[model samples]
Target chain A: MNARKRLQFGVAVAALMLAGAAGAAPVKVGMITTLSGGGAGLGIDTRDGFMLALKQAGDAASEVELLVEDDQQKPDIAVQIADKMIQSDQVDLLTGIVWSNLAMAVVPAATAQGKFYLSTNAAPSALAGAGCDPKYFAVSYQNDNMHEAAGAYAKKAGIGKVFIMAPNYPAGQDSLTGFKRFYDGEITNEVYTQVGQTDYAAEIAQIRNSGADAVFFFLPGGMGIAFMKQYAESGVDIPLIGPAFSFSQDILPAAGDAALGVMNGANWSKDLDNPANATFVEGFETEYGRLPSLYAAQGYDTANLLLSAMSKADITDADAFRAALAEADFDSVRGKFSFGPNQHPIQDFYIREVVKEGDVLTNKIVEPVLTDHADAYAADCKM
Target chain B: MLLVAEQALNGLQYGMMLFLMAAGLTLVFGVMGLINLAHGSLYMVGAFACAWIAAATGWFWLGLLASLIAAAAAGALIEILVIRRLYSRDHLDQVLATFALILVFSEGTRWLFGSFPLYLSLPPALTGAVTLPGGLQYPLFRLVIILVGGAVAVGLWLMITRTRLGIRIRAGEADREMIAALGVDISRLYTIVFALGAALAGLAGALVGSIQSVQVGMGEPVLILAFVTVVIGGIGSIKGALIGALLVGMTDTLGKALLPGVLARFMDASSANTIGASLASMLIYILMAVVLILRPQGLFGARA
Candidate 1:
């Protein structure tokens, strides 16, 4: 009786231990973002913000494993990292690319391979439209949303003639198109500069002579900082307006007082009035010793969304996990976050004014520009 | 008309900066016969040094001085440690070695300064615009840059024509073996020339850093333009570099400013802007190709 009972008990315990291990095994997430070169600020913020969310979750996030890598802001390197993450690392989800060009190179392929991709920053229109995949979700707004909001704001202000400028790229083209879609005013001039251009003296001279009441531009990262400084020094006092990419926390310090009084379109800000946002802004500062940009907010929300989905459904159940992610049951710092038809965010956009909060330059929400905004290409998506 | 005038001034300012970069590159190539791709890394070193010192000391001028010293020192160190070995090697070896140095310098910088860009502000005195003829307002700092470039050009001309060191540099450029045979202390001269060139590049970086973001890899874009300037000006001619830089700068700036307007006369504004910008970016290269076709030895290059 003793030998038979002892053998059965040992077998039962070993089976139970194996079952627990399978159930509690962490969900693997691969983050491929720029962490070197000129664009590292955005990627560092993304990684920090995502890690912050995981840290705050503490015991609740015990079942999550994160693997982070730098893409160096290059499309080829991003593609290579994506391939490695999917094939060798076998991560359940991939996220954290800062540039649209890199995202375009990596996202379609990764999603096609049946891996879920939660975009932290880049939300290219191509991926939002006919290229949309059920396996991909953009936690941030569409690339056009902020520019479209700027256009809407210009329209609301009744600006008669506006000068618009952007870099010569797909996202840049989308920026101007989005602005024109919402504003019915006369465009005094439409200029497209070389991508990564540092000098804007020629553009400023044209803006001064164009008889435009306001100027709109969309130059992100280092390009934006350069243009803003040069524009400020050029003394073209025409009111400057743009998407928040140029005026985010990451850029504002480098731009210094040059960014003061500029109005920019954004979906979130540190001064946003919500419990979740307040917690996020304060937590980010306390954790990273700096203010969080909208990119950081997006990264935080992406991680929280994954956590919520994990709580609702097991990662092994693809359909259930997709449905759970679509639910977006997390409290987003952006307030009232929800996915549109194409799985891109449908959210309110606001006009933010760059002002000095103490010694630090930061943005504050002045007013709402677009209410429950959705991308124009969502109708083209089949799923 | 005012817009055109303003753009021309902009072009002049841009050309001045390019001249600073190309002068050093041309000198190094002419005297050393070495292709140094890491010249841009020295420029970056200057910008980072300026930004860091300026932030620490709260004095922009002090930062500028630091940029020069830091870049010159870095240049001399590399010359002694790495570049000296490459002098006897082939051009491919030099290129490979310098290219590897770029990676090393970039990673080392990232390690020291972290990844985010540093801010370098213009002093209050040069912060505002000055009114020009026809009511055009231009930045005072840019005018300063133009003045500084002109002064340097004059200074370099004087040195080349009058100084003993300049004569040695010229002689070295003409025949390295002859200069060495004459007991010119060739390695020391090479180090000095390289450092002098690096100092020029560093000054350009510091001057430009106030306007642009002082981030790692910032020098690469300007480096490409400097290479273009060198090729167009003849690889070894300082005067040629000046003229080529201005030509390239003017072509680039004016093409960007006027091409869209010209195209808008025939096409819709959006398509005109898109197509015109694309064409404008290619304008400088086009100019270079035309110059090469017209003068195979470059505008000022000596015939082989």
Candidate 2:
């Protein structure tokens, strides 16, 4: 109650208030990804990439806490993880979803909470179009973007009577849809099997019987391995084509010789020749002792993008930080990346073939499908 | 017709694989009355063990043997430590506890093996393709699987029907307390049964691992299908499990192969595709539903 004590207290309070007024609290970003099951190969790589970038970026602005949870590759679990992150973790930003269904389940919740969501992967078209949210941004391209590029490449390669197969799911439909969009040739047979199917011998038989000149499949994860292995063993001479998923580094080792000469398209490849990518590829291999998959590349870029946005923004201001992210002013391993109006990535897609470079097998660049191609749903996105 | 025959063979192979998993499940259930949701975890263990051993020794036979022994050991350890206490507990308690075990096993596997999938190579003897009567060139490995499955079916039947241990198992299933009173060492029997079931599951996982990517939680989808098979065949009945597995497998494989083409005749390609894919995906479930309707206790249910 003394005069001197009261004055000191007043000064201390004022200083604390000034500090609070000058900058925002420490930024917290939540990530939900699969840490188990078939998708774990991609999910864990993504986690390592993001964490590495975060560490390289130095101390968290105001002490950034990255809250991470495992979706476990289930939709219900994904939703629960999202809810827990939003409510318990109290993360102001959310990112990291590799599966399209999981992304679709998580995005609306983040956006409705006024949180910025940076999608590391999984770019369903609806989000880019009618379902777009101003606060949501994708560090990776839309789901269909890679497949669309594959279709265009197939057309250019003079492939005809292509038999298309995909898992019978929404994302599967999107992949085939994307492929068919640019492929104006005759599709001999379009088959959709149950999601997570192991044996594709029956479908392969059907394809062989149909006399299709080539095959385009969208089998991802373990399904890809099983199908490619079986297809190769069946001695079918038809050229097999698909997106990066069916023949990625994570899958190729399992597919073994079956993966040789398999053509696909992707946004990022181990062999991409950009300086940023070269650094990433080298650093990832040295750190992890394995070649980085596309998932890892996207994950690394996601964290880097966030850091770039943070450096650009007054870290204390949430609105400014969100705005900076929306602008997407960052160098990406994919060479170039910019956010379209729908907050999804507008990037290049490359046609790649599995080839042996010395002792190691990796994707070799065959052609570029599109340069700075925007997503098809951008115009539909009112935002 | 060739496609149909090939697809039917695919179904048979898939069903036999299911029988391998389901037989173990039904054995554990029929004798011990334990739900053991962690059965899938055991399958995963078998796969990992096979891949690890095969890579280390460069011997496929040794790897397969290791898978069986590892799986059995794992099953015995689990049964003694955790599952033994759970035998007297409620199904929900068992389900929740086993579910926890699933998380532990999954996390443990990931921690030990990291996230990359392990690949298993086929033995050279079973690596090539064989032409079937229908002019379809099927993988020789798949044919071996079908043949092994048939042999196992006969072997299991002989064991259960003709052997003294089989009689003891049957007696134990009928009256656990009486069998124990007769000095059958019930605990040992239970452990043996559990280990045997786990070994079967492991063998199944090892057989299929070469064809598929061996990874964490890979056992779960197959486990679900096995559950459907057992349910449709009559839970706790070995014969039921066999019949159910084959039926469910054929329905799933053949339905997927033929449904789209059948629909295409009457509808446009796109519409037929949408309908066919949906139906094909649901075919096994539909079969389960039909079985439930016709025989609530299952196809070969003993009078209860």
Candidate 3:
């Protein structure tokens, strides 16, 4: 109650307030990803890779505090997470949704509200084309970008007949369209199975009877695994072509020997010879005790992009930060990586063959399917 | 002719697996009058146990045995701790409780095994193919699944017809209070039936795990189809489950194969193919609706 004591208390409060104002709180990020469901593998890898980048970014990560939440691949939950991030956490940046559906749910709405949304993996055509936003940046290629590479690869292989298969959904439709755009061949058949369909037996029978020389399928996650297993066992040896999601490092081990020799198109691979990629692959393997999938690679690159952008511009300035991200000064694990006019990645697509390196099954880059290719939807964006 | 035969065989294989899952689900539902939604969780448990054990031991058969044991034991434990209380409760409460079990099992398994799908390879003895008559080579593992399912069907039929447990189950279904008054250890009977059903589902999971990706939530899709099979077959009847599964599997497979080409004859291939594919996916549900309308109780369902 004494005057001297009260004076000391006032001084202490002033010092505390001054210190709080002087040293800034860490850069806050909110990540909503599918982590507990069937698609958890993809989301988990993305989160791990993103965190690994933050950790290795040294002092940069020290300034970053990430709040991670599982969306469970549900759009409603993703929206809630985004709302919480924007309202409660007041996050500087938001990222980390694995599925295209989830991204479509989160990105447009989040970015429209003036929060920067950096996509780790899904880049649906809606965002890339006419709906593209300046605040939205896709560190990953468009959904169709890699599949087009597969189609291009098939065309180069001189396959006379190509039977196409995909799940009956928007992405599936995109996959088939992407393939057909580049592939010059006799279309034997185009069959769309139910989404999340595990049994490909009937489809395989159709393929066999169709007399197709090659097959290109877009059945991601467990669908791809099921299809590949059944296809391998069915004794139909026609070359199977799929996008990288089908033959990624995470699911490759589960697809077993069936996935071996299967060809896929990807923007990033575990075995890319670039120094950045080499550091990422080695560090990721050492840290996680498994090879990084393309999803992980995308997550790593997105984090690096965000950090570099943050260093270049004040996070509070939207225009400056967006411009800095567009600069893309960070060394991408994918060599020669850059953003297109639509804010989606413009990167080379490699034809990777699933070959066993020693006892482990992994992808090896065979050849370039498309070099410095931008998505077909980039031109449609008015932005 | 070849495509038809091959498609038919595929249908048969898929149906048998469903029958295995449905038989257990129906038995549990009929005898206990409990609609256990966590049946899928048990399937997932079987798959994870089989995958982990097989990987650790490097023996597929041993893993199969472990799966059956693990699922059965888990089922019995769950029955004792949770399902026993639900048996006296209404279907809604039972549903909610079992639904909770699904989250528990799924998250628990994910915690244990991580999110990556596990691959269970076919045994060496069952690997490769057998050229049937006219050189229609089918994967021997799939053929073995067919054979094993047939044997189980016969074995289940014999057990139901010729065993005391079967008599108790049928008599219990007829009247729960009467069976209880007659000194049937009702709780023990329920546990035994539940464990048996869980075993069947677990066995199905083990058999199908090699052919499909073994991962979390792997069971839900198959479980939904199995429920359809059980309902269309008449919920409590083993024979009905078999018949309904075959119908579903056959319709689903053959429709996917035959509908597209047949529809192509009427319209342009592209639009027809798209319509046919969706229609094909819906064919089973259509079949179920038709059956429900024709016979409310189901094909083999006994008069209530």
* B197-254 per-residue lDDT for model 3 (tens digits): 9988898888888777688888888899999998899978899988998898889778
Going through the candidates in order, what is the number of backbone clashes in each? 0, 2, 0
Per-model CA lDDT versus the true structure? 0.89, 0.84, 0.86
Can you write out model 3's per-residue Cα lDDT over A213-255, one digit (the tens) per residue? 8888887766777777777777877878889988987678767
TM-score of each: 0.94, 0.89, 0.92
lDDT of 3 at A340: 87
List DockQ for all candidates. Answer: 0.60, 0.53, 0.51
* Model 1 TM: 0.94
How do the residues A33-67 of candidate 1 rate in per-residue lDDT, one tens digit apiece?
98876677889889999999999999879888999
Ranking by TM-score: 1, 3, 2
- By lDDT: ranked, best first: 1, 3, 2
**Weakest lDDT window of 10 consecutive positions for candidate 3 chain B:** B265-274
Candidate of highest DockQ: 1
Deviation in angstroms for A210 in model 1? 1.5
> Considering summed lDDT, which 10 consecutive residues are worst modelled in model 1 chain A?
A17-26
Candidate with best TM-score: 1
